[model samples]
Target chain A: MKARVFVTLKNGVLDPQGKAIANALHGLGFAGVGDVRQGKVIDIELAERDEARARATLKEMCEKLLANTVIEKYEIELQA
Target chain B: MKSAVIVFPASNCDRDAATALKQLTGQTPHMVWHRDSELPQVDLVVLPGGFSYGDYLRCGAMASQSAIMRAIKAHADRGGAVLGICNGFQVLTEAHLLPGALMRNANLQFVCRPVALEVNETQSAFTRKYEHGQRVVFPVAHGDGNYFADDETLNRLEGEGRVALRYAPGQNPNGSARDIAGILNQKRNVLGLMPHPERVVDPLLGGTDGIKLFQGLLETLS
Candidate 1:
């Protein structure tokens, strides 16, 4: 099985990198871009195809490494 | 007095911290690797600044979970004095050794420069050399040094006199609350500060304000 983890700064937390990217996009003549937030997607390969177990493991990974709970949150998806 | 400096793989300031300790105490500190399970029996332990674990997952986030931090936690639990500077401070927060977390500067840029800090609390072991409200200069180089905590935590910190240093008037380099530059644990044995005091130790390095901080540690352990 393969899993993907998406980690992003919580809504209320400041996302400096996202803001910088938004500014850069606006400078490049992009129009009507209401908002922009940046996040990371981490892909991992697992030996088992159990989606439930993979999700649990990914949550643990997020708490331990994939995300910083202090400022960011994470979601996981597993694919067969 | 025995002292040790924890060295994570990417810790660029380890040597500077060790030198400051050696010069101040005339006792060379043991350089403990992050992989080690135990720290040397010492009165003081320093977590120096730099991009630990390449600042991945978040500044100091990954480094906080390294093997040595467990030992460091144990040492701190035993009331050993621990001082964390810059990235070290970030790690301490990520390790849950201190309240609050550091976020990117309000300007969304990496700030590297000398900033003035006023001693906010002089009762802690780390600030005994300076009187309350005394000013000192130290260099800060980091993208995330704006400390954040809940209102209750902030109030508790202020009420307990755990705020050890504050950026002086008009020197809000990182936009930290109350221009906070450093804080101590509730017990006052652990200190986490964003300024690079080690960089300001030598008089020829354009400042000597930081020498007093290291000297204060030496005095405490002796």
Candidate 2:
């Protein structure tokens, strides 16, 4: 199974990098960009054939190291 | 007081911390590597600054899972003194030994300067030497020093007197929430701060405002 993780800053948390990206987009004349927030995507390959087990493992990984949970949230996707 | 300084990969302040320990405590600090699982017997453990693990994924995130962290956590659990400065502070937060997270500066720029900080709570071993509300200049050099915490956590820290240092008025270099510069854990044995007190420990090193911080730990832990 292959797992994909998306991590992003929580809604109420301050994200300076995301703000910079928004500003840069505006400077480039992309005026429609509003409240732009940035996030990271991580792909992992797992040998576990069971979808349930892979998802559980991915969730553990996300909780342990992929996401801080203090200012960020994470979503995991599994593909068998 | 006898102490040890954890040396993580890319840690640039370990030597400075050792020098400060030698000068302040008159004892050499054990330089323990991140891979080492056993922590020597010491009253205090110092985590110095610098980009650890190349700041991969997140600052201090990779290093927080280091093998030595278990021992360090054990030390903190025992109510031993643990001081994390700069990148070290990031590691402490990542390790969950301290609350809150340090985000990128609000200006999205690296801030490096001698920032004025007021000692808010001098009851902890890390700040007892300084007078409450005293102002001190400590050099801060980092890109992610903006501190953040939920309102509940913020209020609890304030109520418990766990906030040890705050930026002096108009001196918030990184826009940290509530101008918090340093904080102590619930037990007040672990302290994490973004400033580099080790850099200003000697008179010849531009200033000695950080001497009292080391002295306080020496007096309390020794």
For all candidates, state DockQ relative to the true structure: 0.61, 0.90
Output the chain A TM-score of model 1: 0.92
Clashes of 2: 0
Which digits, one per residue and each the tens of the lDDT, describe model 1 over residues A1-80?
Answer: 99888998888777767888889999999997757889999999998777788788888889887787877888888888
| Cα lDDT computed for each candidate against the true fold | 0.89, 0.94
Against the true structure, candidate 1 has what lDDT?
0.89
Q: Put down candidate 2 lDDT per residue, A1-80, tens digits, no spaces.
A: 78889999999887778889999999999978998889999999999999888888888999999999999999988866
Q: Which sections of candidate 2 miss by over 4 Å? A: none
Cα RMSD, model 2: 0.8
In model 2 chain B, where is the ten-residue run with the lowest total lDDT? B104-113
Candidate 2 residue pairs in clash (backbone atoms < 3 Å): none
Q: Which prediction has the highest DockQ against the true structure? A: 2
